[model samples]
Target: MKTFTKKLTFYMGKGHIVRDITADIQAVVNESKIKEGQVTVQAGRSVCIISTIEYEPGCLSDLEKALEKIAPRNDYYEHSKRWNDENGHAHIRSTIVGPSQTFVIMNGKLCLEPWQQIIFGDYCPNEHPEWEVFVCVIGE
Candidate 1:
């Protein structure tokens, strides 16, 4: 078995953002020469997540809307008092969604549907100035 690890740094760009990581991850798998296994995308933060979904304008809008519904920003969050962060809902939302996603890599390519894309789902966390991402590959 072979294993590889890579960390990427990024700057948040306001609002909800879904950045594609398919190509970057593919490069990692290629470097490891892993013909079959899995790639996990992990967000190194308390308020970020990963998901596989279609990337489109309306869909992006819907995603932002959905997060709002799942964890409304205006809602009262006791955590805010503890940390004094207005984005307590963001942390809750990311917790519920998750911080990492694993994708199966087959025949040296990501095994994903046609419309499915690896997206770094950034809610309020995207508004921050700094962010970190983890990419780990383990395969033959």
Candidate 2:
């Protein structure tokens, strides 16, 4: 068995935003040279999420809207009261969306549907200079 690990960093703008990271995960898999394996992509921060989705404007907008409805930014949260910060909604969204995703690698390629793409979601209310993603590939 072989294992390959890589860390990806991104500077994200303020507000909730989603960015396609399928290519990055594939790049790591290619670099690992493992034909059959599993790749796990994890967000380094609790306020972020990693998942697969259709990388399109409509889907992106809908995702944001859904999250907003689930965890409204203007709603009062006990986290904000304890931390004295305005990112309570961010934490809630991240927790609901999760922080990592695992995908199968077959014949040195990611096993995903045509419309499925890995995405990184930053739900922080403020600009984040460095958001980190850790990719780990294991198998032969």
Candidate 3:
């Protein structure tokens, strides 16, 4: 079995941001030279998440709205009370969305539905928008 790992970083604006990372995961799979295997993509922080979602603008917008409804920012949370911060909703959103996703690699390519794209979503409302995603490909 062969394994390859890559760390990716990017900046996201305030509010909710979803960025597609399908190509990046494929790149790691290609580098690993694994014909059939599995790849895991994980977010490095609690305020961020990795999942599959439609990359279209409308779908992305709706996802953001749905998340807002699930964890409204204006609501009070014990997490914020403890830290004196305003991103309690970010934590809730990330927990619901999850922090990692695993995908199958077949024929040296990611096996995904045409419309299902891997996404790195940052729910933090902070000024420093840097986020990290780790990709690990394993198998032969």
Candidate 4:
């Protein structure tokens, strides 16, 4: 099996920002030249999440609302008190959403539904000067 690994960097603004990264991951998979295998996309931080979603305004809004209901930023978090930081909710959201997603690579392309796109979410309450995403493609 062959493997290709790459790190994608982004300057992220304050909390609750989501970006579509399907094309970026697909580019990595294409560069790997792996006709059949798996591509794993991972966030480098605990406060970030990697998952699949429909890249659209309505869907994005819905996701935001849902996450808010699940983990309200205003809620009390012991982690915040311990760290003297206000990003406890961010960690919770990241844990729930997960930090990585693996997709099949078929014919040198990422196998995903037309509407399903990989997304990276920054949940930190503060701005991140640089956020890193790691992509690994492994296959024959």
Determine which window of 10 residues in candidate 2 has minimal summed lDDT.
9-18
lDDT of 1 by residue, 97-131 (tens): 88999989899898989888877766673367777
Per residue, candidate 3 scores C-alpha lDDT tens digits across 1-140 of 77888888887767467889888888888888899989999999898889998799999999988998999988999998999878899999999989999999999999999999999988877755577888898898
- Write down the worst ten-residue block by lDDT for model 1: 121-130
lDDT of 2 by residue, 1-140 (tens): 99999999988888688999999899999999999989999999988999988999999989989999999999999999999878899899989989999999999999999999999999888887889999999999
Ranking by lDDT: 4, 2, 3, 1
RMSD of 2: 0.8
Compared with the true structure, what per-residue lDDT tens digits does model 4 show for residues 1-140? 99999999988778789999999999888888899999999999999999999999999999999999999999999998999889999999999999999999888889999999999999999877889999999999
Residue 54's lDDT within candidate 3 is 79
Query: Each model's TM-score?
Result: 0.91, 0.97, 0.94, 0.98
Which residue runs of candidate 1 sit more than 4 Å off their true CA positions? 125-127
Instruction: State how far residue 40 of model 1 sits from its true place (Å).
Output: 1.1
Q: How many clashing residue pairs appear in each of the predictions shown?
A: 0, 0, 0, 0
Which stretch of 10 consecutive residues in model 3 shows the poorest summed lDDT?
A: 123-132
